[model samples]
Target: MSELVEHVDERDRVLGVVERGEAERQHWPHRIATTICRDRAGRILVLRRSETHSRFPGYYDVMVGGAVDGGESYEEAAARELSEELGVREPVRFMFKFLCREGTSPVWFGVHEAVVTEPLIPDPGEIAWQGWLTEAELCEVVDQRLFVPGGRKALRRYLESGSGSGAGELGAE
Candidate 1:
């Protein structure tokens, strides 16, 4: 079972601890993660969550992401999630960190960006569909409300930066 770290208010102050299941049921604020995957052409990868997920099921989101463990750093969680969800073996660079509070529970969100030069194998349980889009197309989705609220915010930040820093810093080719 997944474990969750608890927090307080919209600011994400630490409260106490709770099990992942309990936290989900109780709507406790916790840390959420997001990763941006860029192809050699600078297109970004996005995916649709499996319909089986309890929250935001079947919604389009970042390439890979998840909740952070109790003592995990944002960068570690982002890197771990990338490998876990997409079978990516390259190192992930840190980008921006933001908080998303649109849900019943607030989320301390970390945005990371990575450039992929190899093949990707997405986790079926976490991803139902995947595709690459230009910045304009991605922004259009955000405008049309195609992504979850937190994802929208994260994407906007990424686009505005003109860098995938929301995902991470790109390495030299």
Candidate 2:
């Protein structure tokens, strides 16, 4: 399916409409996206992007993520992505938001983390590789630039804050 996207100013207010490709190419107004991080036992789930992706192909990143639909809240978008990408429907706890201006398209991104005790059933087309990593090991991977730049920053901030709790400002009802 083609991506549905909108251009927005630095404050995340809509400025105009643009095809996803044009927005990325021109770094038009910022867009909204979300990342989901899941922990199981003492390890976190991470995945390598399919080499076919338009951006950051072959890079390892947080378990699940995608662009938020117009008018969808970050939590809603995150939960939808979790289920679509991993076939997991567990509740997601809010982490934080990260602004990524380094990409072809600047983005206002939300970060979420969840704990999963059940086995994951990931979509092969969406993920090239998947594995569990300890927190320290994950940080090492981040240091080595394994994850998308914005993802790395969000993960670091989440870890440093020591709050596994949700932000409370937004939640799935």
- What CA root-mean-square deviation does each model show from the true structure? 5.4, 5.8
Backbone clash pairs for candidate 2 read: none
Model 1, 1-173: lDDT tens digits are 65766554466676776776677667667777668889999888988988986668888886478877887777888888888888886677777877676754667787888898878888888888889887766655655545777776776677667673333222111
TM-score of each: 0.84, 0.83
Poorly placed runs, candidate 2 (over 4 Å): 164-173
Question: Which residue ranges in model 1 land beyond 4 Å of their true spot?
Answer: 6-13, 164-173
The TM-score that candidate 1 achieves is 0.84
Worst 10 residues of 2 by lDDT: 164-173
lDDT of 2 by residue, 34-138 (tens): 555556555667889888876688888764778777667778888888888888887887677766776556787777777766678887778888888767667
For residue 143, give model 1's deviation from the true position in Å. 2.8
